[model samples]
Target: MTGLRVSVGDVVDFGAASGDRNPLHLDREFALRSAYGRPVAHGALATIVALGLAADREELARVVELSVDFDQPVLPGLTYRVRRSPRGVEVRLGELRVLTARWTLADRAADTAPAAPAARGAGADRPGPPPLPDGGGPRVLGLAELAGLVDESYAYRVDSAALAELLSRGAAAGVPDALTGPLAWASFHTGMRTPGRDGLLVGIRLRLTGARERPAEVWSCRAEPPLVHRRTGMVTVHAELDGAASATLTLVSLLRRQVAAPTLVETLGTLPRSNALAGRTVAVIGGGRGLGAALSCSLAGQGARVLAVSSTPATALTREASAERLPIEPLTCDARDPEALTTAFSGVALDGLVLAAAPRILSLPVAAATVPECVDHVADAARLVLAPLAAAHELLAERAFVVFVSSSAVLEPPAAWPHYAAAKAAIEGLAGHLARHRPGLRVVVARPPRMWTEMTNGPAGAAGATPVGVVAGAVVRHLLSGPAASGRPDVLGPDALSGP
Candidate 1:
């Protein structure tokens, strides 16, 4: 398998075919704020592609059981490869494994029973129920309603030739034409009908029971009541399809965890108002969201004219700044592009500079990390500061302060985040070098503990994390009123928050 990439157009087509229009897969802005950090291809889409690749070696008609475990998200625009595994096949984005699959072949021939027609309702063509509430509660649905959920686009009018044509051009190839319809229906039933929006598919087990020579004109699917485990947030849905072919599917999914945004009022109220940073102008890179936004707000509260530079437009922050009469100007620019950074800060002379931009953290083991992944992290980290630093060189006031927002993980590296730890460590070294070479500059490296932000909103990521405002307040105080510059980088740890 080679030359396989999931484009935005492919995602749209998949959404129409499967009726799964989850924002995580379709909406760029929504996905930018989500845990994955960008639009990711559907897990079912990945699974089907893997199966199609496997069909090259094995016969699909002889396969009795197929199981797939989704390990990591399959991001769009990346080429993936399929390799034979001890189980069956594994999909890889470079050396990192994204999905694992196992296939079981039947000893005898497949059953040749006449497939039963599915039960239909008068309102079968109507839209199904809405997604679960945002507040997080149980949604009750009768089993019949779940069974009768119909996909208007591709369920009744499945085109095996079209599916085969689509799969043949990508990394997915060699899928038997007869198996395309059943495989697609399995994806549609799991993604759109049963668990719906909140579901994060963990694994899927598909069993082919009967064989059909041609694709069905009208395929009907029936699903049983989903078995949900409240404590583990796991849901299992069993579904049976009857058409030209008959198959049974068992889908295991986990409900996605969501963290509530902290109240801005409460966060601001915790800090005392002071004019210590009065008349100072500070440029905060990546100030549109996460800790950068919190730092911008805190700095503005302390009477500094803050330039909130971010890749995306900071609409909400801009509105808040205006309503509060705060001197926080939002500037949109990509930190990777030096020209853009220079243009965004054309006339601004900064009294202080904060390097707070960072890429979305991924939990990839060092052994599994590819060359591109490592280089990308290091490059991103370097660009975030290097570009802004170069652009602000002539614009800096005499003896201006510079702050680098390093992470505590640099010292106590997480086993799963070697790339992140290495990148942070590299920048900290750069900060030290700058302090040594530029004697007049006040350099500070602030290593804060994990803070509650969009980057760390996942359950495991949020554990033991400090509030973003608290950390931002401490950073602001240290920058303005802490000890004078020591000529070397002043490395501040979590203990710095205990100071006056």
Candidate 2:
């Protein structure tokens, strides 16, 4: 908190000097006809005070840009504290009560210079600061950089007067002390607030274009009405930025800090929605580790309720994965054990089943220690999920999608190992048989040559493999497109791959 005070006269002088001579302020007679019935300070005035605090605190003293979201009007004389940030500062009143300011500072020394003190009232004689910055200051804001500064124009046709008011002045709500706890209510909305999620919000990213710093103060933040659907709540936020690049980045960073579980609501309001995967429950049999984790996360993100099953009550890989808050629910079931696996997924009515968990089927040299261990790792994982889906025909919700993950190793088996090749062949056979017999369920198989998933890339990612996201994306396409038009098993091998 930086101690910066602005007397009422200072607020008036700041507004007057800035060339904003709105009738509500400069004329007492004009103000008498207003709704507040008196002159009120400009919302930008509070932003200026906050920027001064940031200037006092940070290395950059000259503010390049500032944005502010006004809450209730600040009548003359009531004070505000300057909340300082690394990029700039905010002028705040009360608790984390309505957001008050966002400001960004930069080295504008090249753009602005002190005057030589005019010889009388010849303020007009003084020149506007020295010319051009490339020869002086930057002539063009970088295309990429200027993109960060665009204030996203808003659209709200619900009310004309309200829209006009919003365009002129932004509004904000006070945030609760614990943004991670529950909703933060204000008198304006009658105890309205966003529901707090159990996990951390992690970070707040501005869905803005290009590169931009998050400004400390945002002008014209409105307390938007909550858009609720299916018992879920969302709030739409529209914030303005000061300058382009740094301001966008700085302000976004600050918003990320302030937003956590409790206060971070899904900001996407009622935009158009498509039922791309409607009535689908994707099942991941070997979801405990590696590629399995990748598939589960991908499917879940696409609006599928993922049924993540792994063979162990706890595997080293699964335990680490359990801690991650993903769209899928991680459950234990040994892929090798059929009954335990059946019990694990008995409750789930699945739509798609992805077999990502493959046992370690690496082939060590013939003379190497414990060859059996290598076969079990890759081979067993394939069998585990395949057997149960075969028996419990009821688990799938009729006309389901089944995807099996295979490897390119079988086509070009490493000279050092042969067992891994055999297991993968058997896995492919299982998928083929299922696809042939089950006309109702669409069976899909993807044989990735080398994916960055744990299949090729270990936890540390020492082994170079194709990026998991790209591989997963390919798999997703297969799931959506369904069986090939040729109707043959989907076979991917080393020869089909283009890049290393």
The best candidate by lDDT is: 1
TM-score of each: 0.78, 0.40
lDDT of each: 0.70, 0.42
Model 1 residue 160 lDDT? 42
lDDT per residue for candidate 1 within 85-149, as digits (tens), equals 65577887656677888888766545552222233345544333222223222233333343444
Would you list the clashing residue pairs of candidate 1?
none
**Candidate 2 structure quality by residue, lDDT tens digits, 71-127:** 434445444456655544555443423234443433443232211111223343322
Clashes of each: 0, 45
Error of 2 at 373 (Å): 4.8
